[model samples]
Target: MMLPWALDVARERDIPLAVFWIQPATVLATYYHYFHGYGELIASHAADPAYEVTLPGLSRPLRIRDFPSFLVDTTGGEVGKVVNAVFCELFEFMDEQRRNVKVLVNTFDELEPAALAAMREHLDVFAVGPVVGSSAEARIHLFNHAGADKTRYMEWLGAQPERSVVYVSFGSIWTYSKQQMEEIADGLRRCGRPYLLVVRKDGRQEDVSRCLEDVVQERKGMVVEWCDQPEVLSHPSVGCFVTHCGWNSTLEAMALGVAVVAAPSMFDQPTNAMLIEEEWAAGVRGERNGEGIFSGPELARCVELVMGDGARAVEVRKKVESRKGMARDAMAPGGPAERNLRSFVMEVQSSDEARRKDTNTISPPP
Candidate 1:
């Protein structure tokens, strides 16, 4: 969203600019196509949940619900409209300078080869991630130590059995309504799994306090205001993650080998959920009702589908385990992600040197 301003700063200074796309390459391709030619088709069917789009280079067609929420958020009022406008403006800026644009995506090469190749047709694209682990480690060092609440949760996790805990979070920005919060709490309780849920203290805590109180009183789960997410996902007891499919959270789950029950809210989240469930086969997407609320029963069903002693659960776990190995390999020394980063750095350095030489060249007086 802030890419336009960053581009302006880079241009004014004559510095080389590369877009470090925080989302997956598939999402980047979707957005690029939406701006390039498919905006009309998407806009016309924005409210049609069953409408499917076959984007170029995607192996499967995507339903309208699977798109980034901004594209299908017809009833979201002013904020939705503003966000949609911002995306259009941002992509327009990129489209205007497409020739000069280079994208460094936070995904590994083997994960989405087709999508990455499609994006390279229009932009200088590099797949350079699953890079959340090191940054997560760095965050631990910068913070000095975990807080009291964090420590408490860690201890609680220690008490749980291996691969027996459900970790629930919707990233930091999204807050649920009282009804939605109650539904989520009820769902987790119904699933009968020991769970750790994070509810932000962003002034909406009082609204859901009753629901949370019930959860703790029954000893069904533990709720905290905030936590070091990487720590929770890396915990041995955490088996399934009920997530909103935020890019960072998705990557962390992938890197750590935790199965996900996607409950995506907005932005790139829905797309990430699609990748998680359909493309990667690492998890399942929770079903939602007409109101777009993931009801308690549906949530429980999805959770069981991933965590129960079922064939699907076993397959999802196997796929997630495989991807975890792939993520590690991508980040290892001389791996694809590392090699891509090295190549990008060398290109930038070469450009900088050439520019310096051009600036310093002495010309005879005309």
Candidate 2:
């Protein structure tokens, strides 16, 4: 969101700016196409939810519903208009800085090789991720928990058997409707697994608590306001993650080799979910019913598919395990992420020196 301002300030000051894209490179490419080439194509089909458009880097054709919500939201509504304007300005800003632009993506090279490569044609793209701590000592928690103790959850997780718990968290931003909350609770119960579900302490907490009161009291599941996600994903007891497919959570789950049941809700989530299910083969995307809600049975099916002793489940686990090694290797010292970061710094320094030399060589008009 601060991208446009950052670009403006950097350009005005002649400072080299590298964009740290927080979402997948695929999402970056989507936005790039939206402004550069595919805006008309998207606008033409905005009303057709099932219409499919194939982007350059993506392997499969994506339905209109799969595109970023802003693109298909052509209702002439103020929110849609504002979002469209922001993205348009964002891409225009990138275009203005085309020559000297660098994008530092929050994804490992192995994860989105094609997307990263595709972006490189337009900008200096670097895959310097999973941009997470290599160890507990290096971890940084950006959010203040308001003096909440994290040890209780950790201890509870420690008590569970290895690969026996289902970890469910839909990031902090989106709140589930009461009906959706009940559906998820029912799904978790149907899965018949010990689970840890993080429902943020928001307006919906009380309602969500009411829905899950029986489960919480019966020790079938534990619902917390918040927990250290990375720590939870890393725990041995955690087997499958039901996530919103937010990039950070996606990468963390991949890094930890925890299989996922992607219940993507919005923005880049659907894209990430597609990548997880299709490209990486690390997880399955939960099926949404006609109302665009993931029904309890559908969620249960996805969880069982990911966690059950089936061929697909085994394959997904294998793929996740392999990618886990790749993610760790990429983040290790002297690995791809570190090497690319060092190279980016050097290139920026070199560009700065050359620019200085060019300035010094210019003759005064006076």
Candidate 3:
């Protein structure tokens, strides 16, 4: 959406512009195919969750429910209409600059090779991420209020058996409703696993403590406002991640080799969930009810399926372990992602040098 302004600024300054797509490359391909020819088909099947669309470059058919929410059921409200318009505009601009522009995505080549290859046919795409993992030495801590026992959760995790803890977090946004929180509490209790749940301070107004009072009292579960996500995911004791399926969270889980219990609600989350469960075979998506909530039983079932001593869990674990290696190789020295990023940097430097040379060359009596 902000691409136009950035492009204009770059052109005015006679500098090159590259679009940084924060979502997965598969998502970019989905939007591209939608604008090119699949829009009408997707729109016609907006109401049908079971309707499947096989896009040209993607490996699997995506059900309507697997698409980003903005691409489906946009007739319900103005928010959808506005979001759809923004994407339409963004892609229209992308079409115009297809030959000249480059897209740098926050994913690796090993993650979505098909989508990346498809996009490269139209636009210069670079896989320059897993762009997290910078040290926190430069981080400024403004909100440090975790009731002063900040290390308590880490301590609790240390005591648990390896691969026994169920870590649940729904990203930084989207507070859970009281009913949702209660259901989650019930699910965690029934699952009978030592769990760590993160409910941000704003969401605590619903009295989640009271909802999970029994679990907390029994020391089976611990609810904190927030914690270092990479640290938590990398913890030896952490087993499965019950996530909202945000792209960053998905990448973190994939890079760390943690099995996922995806509970996606909106936007690109469902698409990411599809990638996790269907394409990567690293997780199971929790089924949502008519009200778009994962009930207690359903959540419990999904968690057990991923984290239990079952054949499916074993399969998921093996796949997850393989994916961790793929992610590592993508970011390793001289790997595809690293090579692509280095080439992009060299291209930019070459362009800047040529521009400078041209500026310095006075007209020879033109």
Give the poorly placed runs of model 3, Cα more than 4 Å off.
1-4, 11-14, 138-149, 207-209, 356-366
Error of 2 at 352 (Å): 0.9
For candidate 1, the lDDT comes to: 0.85
Q: Residue 237 in candidate 1 has what lDDT?
A: 94
Cα lDDT tens digits, model 2, 121-185, are 88788888997666667876655576555888888888998988999888868788888888988
lDDT of 2 at 270: 79
Please name the candidate that would achieve the greatest TM-score relative to the true structure. Answer: 2
lDDT of 3 by residue, 1-366 (tens): 245577667556755678888899899988889999999999999899899999987888889999998889656788888777777877776676664567899998888888888888878889988765645454334456546354888898898999999999998787888788888988988899999998878777646657756557877878888777777888889989999999988998998889999999988999999999988999999988888888889889998999899999999999999999988888777887788889999888887788789988968775
Clashing pairs in 2: none
Q: Looking at model 3, which ten-residue stretch has the lowest summed lDDT?
A: 134-143
lDDT score for residue 214 of model 2: 67
TM-score of 3: 0.92
- RMSD of each predicted structure: 2.5, 1.9, 2.4
Error of 2 at 348 (Å): 0.7
